[model samples]
Target: MDVNGDLVHGATLTAVLDGSTQPVGLLGALSQAHRIQRLELPVHTMLPVVLRQLMLPIMLDELKAPRDRREWGDRFNRGQFSADELERLEHYLGPHGYGDRFRLFDAERPFAQVAGLKALNGETKSVAQLVPSVASGNNVPIFSALCEADELRLEPGDAVLWLLHAHCWDTASIKTGAEGDPQASKGKTTGNPTGPLGQLGLVVPTGRTLYETLLLNTPVVPDGLAPDDRPHWAWDERPIGLGCNSPAAPAWSQRPATGLLDLLTFQARRVRMFTCETEQGLRVNRVIVSAGDRLTRTPEYDPHTVWQHVTKPKKNQPHQRPRRHISGRAAWQGLSTLLAMDLPEQSDGPYTSLLLRQIGDLRADEMLSEHYRLGAETSGLEYGTQSAVVENAIGDDLPLPVQALLAQDAWLREALLECVDQADQAARALDTLNNDLRRAAGGDPLPRDKGSKPSAQFLQSLDRTMRRLLVGLRTVGADESELLERGQLAWEQSVWHAATSDAGLLLAAAPPRAIVGRTVRNGNKDFVYRSGKASGLFRARLTDILPRAAEERRAAQKEGAAA
Candidate 1:
C-alpha cells in the first residue's frame, strides 16, 4: 500500500518520488538500456490455468518462437506484470483459478552488509561481507550510508552500519555465471531474481564476531489444517534469514529523510526476518527487537556493560531477574530513534490528577519499574514520597477561587482542603482508566486507538474545565484542543500543583462522612480524604457567629432567623 494506505497491484507502478530533488523526480529505471534475459518458468511451478494455457505451448516451442513473442508472450517471463485488469485468485481452487501470481514493486533499495570490526577473539580482518550485494543485477561495491555520521559523501575507513542479510532460496541455482576472478564475477549477471527460490533475509547487528553464513533449510511440509497451529510449525524450510553477507556497496548513497516511509518498510521487513527464528519444541518464543549488547571480551567494545556484567540477578535481590538483551544497542537505539518519529500520536497526560496517581501507584508496584527498566524510581518519578508527589500533582492542576479568597486569612486552609476533595474525586475518575490499563497489562493491548470516553465521572468534568480554560487556543472549538490538551495539562498542572500546593494533605485526611470528602479503596492504594466537620466552631450559622447581622435578624424574625 502507498503512504495513504491505498493498495498497489502488479499494474500499479507507483512512481517513486524523490523529494530531495528541487523538483521531485519520479524514478524510472532505464529498462531499455539494460537488456535482461527473460527467465524461463520452472517446470514444477503450477502456473494458473490461464497463464499455463498461454505459456505452455510457448514453452514447448523454444526452438520455434514468434518475433512478437517478447512483446507479449514473454512479458510475464521478464517479470513485466503490467495489467489493466485484476487477476483474482483462489489458492483453494488449485489453479482452476489463478493463484500465487508474482508481484514486483520495481523498487530496488541498496542495503550494505558491513563487517570487519575485530572479532571477539581479537583477530583483525580486512574483509567485510555485504549480502544481496547484487542491486538490480549490479554489484554494489561501496555505500554512502557507511561514509559519515549523518552526512552525505563516501570515504574509506568509514564505520558502516550494515544489515548482515541472510537470504535463503528453495532452489540452489537458477542462473550462475562466471568471468574473471570470483570477486570480478559479482557485477556480472547471475541468479534468476524471479524464480521458485523464495528468498528470506533475517538481519541482526553483528555481535562480538562476524557470524558465519550457514544454510540449514529443514524442508517444511504443509500441515493440513482445520487445525490450531501454534507458532512452531512443521516445516520443509528452516527460518533462516542469515543466508549471505557482502562487503560495502561500491556506490553508497543516503536515503533522504523524506524517504522515511520507504526506509521503515525496508527495516520492518528486516524485523520480520529477524524475528522468524528456528522453530522451538511445540512452543516458540517470539523475539522482540530492542537494544543490542556486545560481548565483554570483544576489542570493538560497546556499552552494554550492564548486559555483560549483570547476566543474572544481583545477590539477594528477589526483585531482579535475568531477561532478554539487545543484540546491537547502538544500532537499535539509532533505528528506534528514526522509527519513533513515525509512531502514532499520543495524548500528553498527567493532565488529569488521576493519571499521576496511577503512575505513582504503578511505581509502588515495583514490578512495573522492572518491566519498564525504570530502576527504583517509578515512571516520571524518583526518590520522592509517592503521597507527596500525588499531593503536588493535584495541587498544580486544581483551579482555586483565587480572586475571591485572596483577602481572606482562611483562604489557604480552605483551598488546601478543596484540593484534597479534588484528589478524592480524581481518584474515583481514575478507576475506569486504571481498569483499562490493568487490562492492557494483562495482555489485551490492541485497538491502538480509542474513542473519547465522556463517562469518566471526575476526569470528564476536569477535562471540561480544562477545555474552558484553554479556549484561547482552540480553532475548532475548545472541545477538540481541550480533549487533547487536558491529558498533558493534567500532568503539567499536577507538576505545578505538586510544586505549589498542599492538596495531598487532604489525601491523608480521614474520609468526609458524606461526599464532602471520603476514603475510596483501590486495593493497597487507598485515597484518604479529610472527614467532614460535625458541629464544629467553623460550622456556626452567620446570624449566630456575627453580632451585627445576628442582632438585626433576631429582632426582625421570630424564633428561627435565616442565616
Candidate 2:
C-alpha cells in the first residue's frame, strides 16, 4: 500500500530491503519522505506478531556482522542492504533461499509446515481454523460479519501469511492428538500454552522509513549469538509432526531457547497446510495443527518489549516478566516506564525496552537525527477463559520526540516527569470532586466507573499539548529554560481547566433537592451532605493539587485588591 492506500502489486521484499517501500503492521511505518504513510489490513491479534517473527531472521543475521552493525542506520538510509549484505539476506528470504525449506507446497519440506501432518492427524480442518479472527470451533468472533456457514477461501499467499500467524498466536483449545504422540490422552492434546508473543505487550520502535524502522527494532546485544544460536530455518532438521520430538521440534513442552535467534523464530504449534485445486487456482482449504515447542521463560532481551521485575507467589522468587499492555490506555500515559525515566526517589527506574534504549543511544550519538519523530508501536492480545478465547486486541502508536526517547538531559527529563505527575494529581483531584458531588446528592459517594471517564478525557485533552511541549523543547533557537517554564505553565493550566470543567459539569447535573442538605446517622454521630460543604472541600483539593493554578489565582487576587 502507498501513502494513498492504493495497493501496489508486485512490490518485492527487495523493495522494502532497499527502502523503496515501507513495512506495515497495525501501526504503519513512519516515512521521512512522506511516501508510504499507512498500510491497512484486517485487524487480528496475531498479524503484527507474525510480521515481527518474519523480520527476526534478517535482523538476527544482520546483527552477526559487528562492523556493519555500527553503520546500520546510515546504510539503511542510503538504499539499504549492501551488495554482499543483500546477497546474504537473499540467502534466507529469497525464493531459492534455504533450498526447499522456504517452499510453501514442497511435499518433502514445506515452509513453517510439518509435512504429512494431514495423514498423521487422520483428518484435516478448514483453512479458517488457521486464522484467529475467523469463526472456528469454540473461538467464535462476536463482531465478525462472517458465520460458520460462510465458505472461507484463501489464496496461496494469504494461506502462508495466516499459517505463520496461527503458529505465533494459536489459542490453547484442545487439539486433535496426532496418531503416535504419547501426550494425547484420547486422540487430543490439552493444556497447551498461548503463543509466546501472545503473552507480551510487544513494543516495536518504528523509525522514519522501512529500513530505519528495522534498525531501530534491531537492538545490539552485548553477548553475541551463541554457537548454538540459529533461527528455525537454519536448523539442521525440520519439524516432522507431533511424534518427532527433538531440540528443534519440542512437542508439548517448555524448552529453554538456544539464544536470541532461537527465541525470535520460536515455533509454538505444529501445523500442516493442505491445498486443493479449484477453478480459480490452487486454494488452501484445510490444515492440521498440534502443539510445538514453548519457551521455558521470557528471554532476558526480546528487543521488542518492556520487562518488569516481579516475584513468583508460590516459590517466592524474584524474576523479570514482560509487562502486560493495558487495554484503552494510550502509550504516552506510560511515559515514565516507556522512556525508563527515573521516578521521584526510586533508585531503580522502569525496565525500558532494549529497542527504546538503543534508539536513545542513536540519538545521543547523533546517528539518528534528533528532530525526526520516533514511533513506538505497541501490540498485545487480551485472552479469556484458560486462554481458549480471543478477548481483545490491544494496540496503540505514540509518535515520540527524540528528547522523550533519550530523556538524558536532567532538567528536561525532570520537567516532563513533573508535568506527568501534576496531570495525574489533577485527575485524582477531579475524581475526588466527583465523589464529593455524589455525596452532596445523598447518593453513593463512589460511582461505578470511579470517575475514570472524566479522568481519561482530562488526560486525552492534554495529549496535543504534551506533544507540542516535546517539540518546543527541541526547537532550534529557543532557550531551553524559557521553553521549559512556558511548557510547564501551559500544561498546568490545561490540566486545571479540564479538571475544573469536568467537576463543574458534574456539580451542575446534581439534583438540587438532594444537594440542599441531608443528614444520616453514622455510628454515634450525624453525617451531613451539602453542596456548599463539598464545594469548599473540592476548592481546597484543587488548589493543593494544582499549585501553579493557585499561584496564578493569587496573583490575580492581588491585582484586584490593589484596584
Candidate 3:
C-alpha cells in the first residue's frame, strides 16, 4: 500500500503511527497533487479518512486544534483569515502521481526502515549491546546509544520503535534454562516475556520542555506490578482518577454548590450595565436578569448601589493593628499651641484639635529631633538634643506661663516684677493726661478746633492737644497720624477716667497678657490694655452698645416724623 501521501505532519494520525521522512515526502506529494486539482472535500472526510486506510489497525486519536472555533469564525466574519490560512499549510511530502496510480502509502514500513537506518548510522544500537552486561556492571552502552540518538535529531517515536525491535531480538536470542532443550525455549520464555517489541514505553510529545511537560501533564499513575493493571494507553500510564480536583472545590465543598447558584441568581437580579440610546435622549431604566430570562420590567438600577456595596466593607472595617497613644506632655503642649493661635473660622477648631492629637501621637517633636540628628550624623556635625536646646534658648522668651516656670529663680522674678512696676507707673501718668483733656473738652464740644489763642483759644488749644495726645497714645513709633486712624473707632467714644474709673480700675487691677505689642513693621513697643479677661469684657460691652445705638436712631427718626 502507498503510505507517504496520507501521513500529514501535525496531524493526529502522524503522531499516533510515527511519521518518517520518506512517508512525509510521499504524503506531501499526494497533498500537492490534490491541491493542484483543486478538489473540494468535506472537512470531516478529508485527511482523517485517508489516514485510517494508510495506517494498519487504524488507531484514531483526537487532538484539540489549540484555538476556539467559534472565536475564529467570528474573526473570519470580520474579515480576518488567519485560521483558514494556517489550515492550508502543508508540512509533509508524499508520492508524485495522479488518479488510480496515486495512493496513500503505509507509514509503519517506512518508519521501521528509518529506524534500521538510524541504528546503522551510530544513532542507535541493538538492545543486547546497549543493555548493561552482568560481568561489566555498567549501562554506558545504553546511555551512549540514547545520547547519540538524541543528538541525531531522531524523533522520540522512531527511537522508541527501534529500541522495541532491538529488545525483541535480544529476547529471542536469550536462552532459557531447560532439560536438554537449548533450541526448544530459544524464542519462548516462561513469562511469555511479551518480547521488548511490545514493551515499548510511550513518551507524550508535548511542546513544553521535559520538566515543564511532566509538571503540566504527569498523571497519577497507579502503583502496581501487573501490566494489565495499568490505565488506558490514552492516559499515558496515568491512573483513571479524577482529571483534576477543582481549585474552588474545597471552598465550594465547605458550603453548598447551590450557594454559588444563589449568589449568581442574586447578582444577576441586582447587577446591570449602563447603556444609552442615541434616538430618544431620555434615560430609560432597565432591569438586569439572568441569561435566557427576559428583562421585561423596567426597574431602576442605580449604579451608585455598586459603589456603595463595594465600598461598604472597606468603609465600615475597623483597623486591625494597635494604635499609638499620645503622651500627656506632648498632648498638652500641642493643645496649648492650638488654643493660643487665632484660627480663621470656628470650623477650624475641630480640625485643629484632630491635627494636634495626630501630631502629638506621632511624636512630632521627637521626630523632628531624630531628623536633625540624622542630618547631623550624615554630615559629621554635632547636633545636641534639639528640643532641649530650643527650650533653653527661648527659656526667658516663651509664653507667659512657660516663662514664669523658667523664672522660678529669685533673680529672674525680682527683675520681672521691677520691670512690671515701671511700666504700670508710666501707664498711670498717661491715663491722667488723657482724663484732663476729656474734662476740658466738656462733653461733645465743637467737631473741630476754633479761635487761635489764650482763654477762648484754651478750649481750641485743648482739642489740638487732645488730638496730639490721642495720636501719641495710639502710636508706638513712626506715622502717629496713620496709627490713630487705624485704631478701633469704638475706643474714641469710650468713657475716659481720671486714673480711677472703670477703664483705669480694670487696668490697675490686672496686667495685660502683653505689656507691649508689635506690628508687622514696628518692633516691640509699649501699648496699654487691661487683662485678657478685661479685654473680653470690653469687647462684650462694645457689642452691647450696637443695640442701644439702633434704639437711639429709631427715637431720632420718630422725632423727625413728629416735626
RMSD of each: 26.7, 5.4, 41.3
Ranking by TM-score: 2, 1, 3
Off by over 4 Å in 1: 1-6, 9-263, 269-457, 464-472, 475-530, 533-563
Q: Flag clash pairs in model 2.
A: none
Greater-lDDT candidate between 1 and 3: 3
Candidate 1 lDDT over 1-563, as tens digits, reads 12111111211121222312121100111121012111111111111111111122112112121223122223322332222211211121123421111111112211211112111222221112112222211222243233212212111111111111211111112112222113224332222221111211112111111000000000011221112111100111212332211111111111211111111112111100011123321111121111111111211111011111222335754221111222212111111111111112242111111112222233233212211211010011011121111111000112222111122233222323333334343433333333333232332212424533212233333444443432322222223445434433343355233322222232233233322534456688864332222112111322232333335445768655553
Cα lDDT computed for each candidate against the true fold: 0.21, 0.65, 0.22
lDDT of 2 by residue, 1-563 (tens): 22111111211122242334443321122222134432333453443554465655555654362333456556545644455655555454444555335566766666676766633448877778877777888878898667767768876656666777777777888877765456766667888888887877678776665555666666565566676666776766433432324422314466766677777777888787777777886677888887777777777767677867543323743356677788767666776777674322333235777677777777677777766767777878787889997888787776666665564654555667688788787777766666666666777766565445567787888788776766665542224676667667777778778877887887787789656868878799987778777767777887887787789989999999999
Most accurate candidate by TM-score: 2
Sliding window of 10 residues with minimal summed lDDT for model 2: 3-12
Q: Considering TM-score, which of the candidate structures 1 and 2 is the better prediction for this target?
A: 2
> In model 3, where is the ten-residue run with the lowest total lDDT?
373-382
